[model samples]
Target: MTSGSEFPFSPDPVLSGTSDDRQHALQLNPQQLLDRIPVTIWQANDQGQIISLSARWQLITGRAPVDSLGEEFWNSVLLEDRDLSLQQWINACQQQRPFVLHLHLCSIRGNSCPFLIQSEPLLNDTDQLIGWVGTLQSTDVVIPLQSKWDYTQKFLQALLDNLSNGIVACDTQGVLTLFNSSAKKLHGLPLCPIPADEWASYYHLYQADGTTPLPQAEIPLYRALQGESVHNAEIVVKPSQGKPRTILASGDPIIAQDGQKLGAVVAIQDITLRKQAELELRKSEERWQLALQGTGDGLFDWNIVTNEVFMSPQLKQTLGYADHEVDNNFEGWRQLVHPDDLGEVAAAIEAHLRQSMPLYVAEYRMRCKDGSYKWNLARGQTKWDDNGQPIRMIGSHQDITRRKQAEMELARLNRDLEARVTSRTTQLEVAKNQKEALVVKEQEARRQSEVDRAGIKLYESIISNIQLGILVWHSQNLESVDHLELVSTNPAAESILKMNLHVEIGRQMSDIFPSFVGKHPDILLSLVEIIRTQQPRSIENVPYTFPEGDENLFSLRAFPLPEDCVGVAFENVTCKETNEPAFS
Candidate 1:
């Protein structure tokens, strides 16, 4: 045989396409690549004689390549001592199968080294065995590669052991292959090599109650091993050295592509704290229910974001509503507010929600289920989120209709007393005027000057003390433009119009009530007409808005006075009109 025998094998390819293979190739040629690796590639004929060997074989054995051709190649590398590995190789060749053997090779320098020889029979296109091809790897190269793999496995194991959740994995035979640190902490014991039947007892597994022992079939890991996917299987662990812990377990079976069950894995989470919190919440709810029953005040809890409200039974009853009468929402609650009081209630609630007020409080009226309205004293506080947005509100309602009725009655009595006092005062003033007139009549025959002084004093007293606002306007025609100039005003007129008549005495009447010109031109026109015709005219319920935005309704009577003047008398009637109940 020659060193370069023409064999049927093709030249080794330069690795391509894949990143890993290209990285390993390092741009070396086929012969150079074979020599760089820590193995010798060889080819043999059907008769078990070496036909060709790679250039690395001489480097590995430190011998001449041509001298080791044919049967001498095997004899040169194989130890003089016959081994079972050689016999196994012979048997594999006869059976035309693959084999792996461990043997010792001696170099020309008398150095001995252990090596692994793996060989597979080469088949022709027709599936007939043609020859054999194999690799001989030195133990120095094999050992380091094996150590690399072992380090990688240890790194993965440590990573799993440091996780917070417990992990457990088993092989197809139910042998516990992996039980991490969290699992040991939960079980209070190291991994037990017991069979599946005794796993529950060995690991002290129990039902979710923590008292009853769990059966092997009910164990989450065992069920997963049987090709079942278990999720949220709550179990209790009663360790010998620790308190019982509740765990939520989820697991799944590991299956191969061909549907073979390879193993199973399970993850466990501790839920003891969550369970305790749930129990406390249940107890707290019971106490809250008791408190609601003891206090008869109507309670309302509102979620501002969702606009949903929880109306307690007392709240519904206070409004004369059944369970299904009112919708449980913010809009429904707003719809029941009395229209006259809605603005006040809304402002109070908004102030509290914006944190401008410590708490919301407003007295308003709410329409009842029976189509009547009742006074309600509502007080609430808002809860704000971290961003200072109102999230929730809780409030109580108190029925104050009786108290409001009492207040109204007391107010009406006060008005009545005031009216009676005014009527009596008017009668006294009339009697005093009559007495003064009689005195004037009687004294006119004796002292004319004294009668004149008495008459002037009477006129001034009536003008200053009367509640009706009185204004004297002198009609003027300046440059053919008609206007009224205010000449005089009583104290009542100054207070009612919120102006200082002394400062405004000579100002035009149009300037004094400028706001009324556009909206109520009839008031000014009537005053001019009364002056022109010298006839009395009356205007009732004339709406007037002041410069400062205060609004009122006034009933006015304008009559012609002497010297081109008009006398106007007006009284505020806003309250009387507003207090009258509506018919529809």
Candidate 2:
């Protein structure tokens, strides 16, 4: 019509714009418009294949537009949400409405990039769906940053809650930022927020010497804030209700990315048991050294695995070796032992090892460098590992040569003395037996003599009652008349005897009977002859007269006694004036 300049509907009708203007107002170049938008925009067909994408979509995916325009573009969605994003886009196109989905999208580098996608249907003038258009914006950092921060905070709190050792952190302004359960207990305070000014009242740190508060430079946590790590620093914390307690503290600094100091983390441990053990060990070593010195004994430690021996200085001196001269090995020790004692020494050691008992003790000779052997008394004990296997041995050695020599000499002297005593005792016993035998013989002889004397007295008494004069004389010496006395006489002889017969014990017969000595010399001779012959003799019908009486007839009888003695008896006969011999 414009070309023809002819139109039935003309400007007279309510027409203000031309048809070209109307067509221009209703048309848009989707690609060019999408490229101008800030959000990522895309169009997909009913089959969910990408038809077009904005320049921003290519920039975020780092892909060319041609490579990204396909159903495969949905592969860029995270595997966990790909199907859901596709289904949502399809439903929105069918329903002819806008739909929103939150999905993780992957780029060309396979990194997850979160996005919020809002999709709406594109329709034709007949209201039939053509495709879907969508816009995507990255919400990776914004959507979950707060939740992540909250989770991190809770995890840190749990860690602090479960810690056993005290933990504390402070800011550069000396403000308490974090305190753990253990820290509250250590400081003897409730788990309430502490003002900065009151921090010193709850937690007081002291130097190891305990004489004064720790200088700021030496405090572990303070040092840590200055970018230093402290380990095993002693500290003392004064509690509100109790005395101060000792602790070992360690700390390190927490730094930010810009190397700025954030705060410090500190840990404390109680070391009272360790300190007491150290003190006790020192005392034990001192006592051991003193005891070894006092006893003049040397200590030795031996390691079985290494075959090495450690000897005290006293041992070197005792062995007559310089302090460093003696070797510390089994062979070295064996070489120093005397040849004669080596067997016994080795046996003792073998027995100890085999038995796994407490100790082994023995005395043996050890060769000195000067070619002399000295006796040594050694005692050793085996030490075992936890599994009951021997690992080491410790022992003592002492010089006993002088003592041993003295003991040997004393033993020899004792043996000699004992032998001498035994010999003397035997000799004395023999002499005693001989003396006793002699005494017994003497007693027997005395007993026999007593019996003979008793018999002689009885015989003399019997002969004297025979009314005769009796005499006894020694056989070997008849004249000596060892025992002769008047026994009895008739009334005539009692008057003629002229001597007191009762009192004449050792008197000779001649002295007591002197009248017979002259007139009866023959009778005395006969008595002597009978004693010498050990025979009986008699004289009968012999005439005799007394000096003061009438004439009388006398008869004599004599007999030899046993063991050289003689007995004699005499009888007197007189008539009564008629021719009758007197028989009285």
Candidate 3:
């Protein structure tokens, strides 16, 4: 089944063409001839183990021939095509026939290029398989005759499809002639037959702002078709199905040799990631600027090695100087500081840089342009070189004049308060002694008042609990019985009288005790005498009978009271001996 003319050439050398050709051709060695050829020739034993490869293999694939020898050549084939290609080669070897394949070959540069491979098995005189030989030619190579145009077109299409950048082309009439694979993927759609006016909308094209639609004339391909060369114009593509992407376009008008306009082509690169990074960096810088402004602090950077200083505009404005008025150097800044604070400021900086202190901080009074001094807080950190020598320092300066003034005023007030307190000490002592004496007098008066109240309460208690029946009688003039009324009585009086006197409190005493008028008419006379003379009188065992039809004898005593009233006390004397004289 072996073919006669496909690879494994049998006797094709030429020596009869011309004297120069014969000499040159004869001088060429086998390796030299192989290297000069456009195609790579390779050989494998009957078992498909690669045995040899020509140097042209390295030139085209960026791989060494030695690395591809033996079975390792199969590893260089792309994974997607290796299995099919190897199976076809195996079938050809078993049938002892010629083989052909169009497959992709992977290069060390990480690109896959299409190639045409053809092989034929070498047989012994007895038709036993010995080895196989093949020729590898890139698909882009031009074949000799009729199929050349067709192959060229296929080769160009393949090349365009493999590119990472999107490509678009249009004819002179503004009709799109080519939209490569990458272009379709980037725009999320394929070619449309619309006119140039609708190209932007059809392809989802936008301006660099990503919101405004791109004008038809401003489209890169459209401008290029109008004979304009567009370079690095940023465009946005918002696909309906995915996230928007940013692309940079460059294109030129295609002009013929005779200056005739043929067409236009544009190449676009996706720059979405780069643009996003730049946007984030810009926002971060804006935030940093806002922070510096919010804190009202100015920036400073000093090059310790070069003795150069840089101060921010805010710092210069705080000092009442124009941007260029102040010299930017350590000595210039030192002159602005108060003469007394320069030593401590320099010491702080030295300690941080030389002694490896964590921070450099100094508070001092600085003189402004108007010859006024203001307090300032300066803080910084140092950057060191590989040898640990301080090379630079960067920091901020804040105005603390108001805070420093407040502190000084508070200190002065505290001193004045101490002196005033010392002066008032004698007066306070005299007032304390006087107040103590007054407190002692008040305490004695309060104790005496408490004793008087206790004695009054005791006397009333004795009066209320006395067993003698006592009654208080009141009169307006002691003139008539209708004019006097019984006022009050005690519990003991009610018990002795054998009646509830509380209910009879408002009755006239004559109505209460009829004995005053009838039983012993002397009792009435004695009562009248007692009322006229405010003297107390007593009666002894005067047999008194009466109003409830019982006879009883009781000793009675009457005492005149203030308020035209009299208090009468009586005892039940019915059990006493009547023969003895009751009064002594």
lDDT of each model, Cα atoms only? 0.75, 0.65, 0.75
For model 2, residues 1-584, the per-residue Cα lDDT tens digits are 10111111112222236887546534534334445557776667766567666677776777765566677678678887675566555544555666666678877576878788777776778987777767788885456695685689899988987988888876554345567887777767653334334555456766665557666677677777777899988877777676666788899998899987666777887675677767896775544543343234667777786898877767778878886888877777778788888888888887887764457888998888688888887888987666866777788776767556655655564565566665687665665565465456555555654564455455445433544454445544656543454432243345445545556555667776566576766766776667678677666677765667657766556666544555655555554345343322
Cα lDDT tens digits, model 1, 465-515, are 767788878878622224788887788988888878878888886677666
Weakest ten-residue segment in model 3 by summed lDDT: 1-10
For TM-score, candidate 1 versus 2, the one ahead is: 1
**Per-residue C-alpha lDDT of model 3 across residues 412-467, encoded as one tens digit per residue:** 54565466667777665564564455455445544554564455455445554667
Q: Any residue pairs clashing in model 2, and if so which?
A: 468-570, 469-570, 470-568, 574-582
Predicted model with the maximum TM-score: 1
Report the Cα lDDT for candidate 2.
0.65
**All candidates' TM-scores?**
0.41, 0.35, 0.33
Q: How many backbone clashes does candidate 3 have?
A: 0
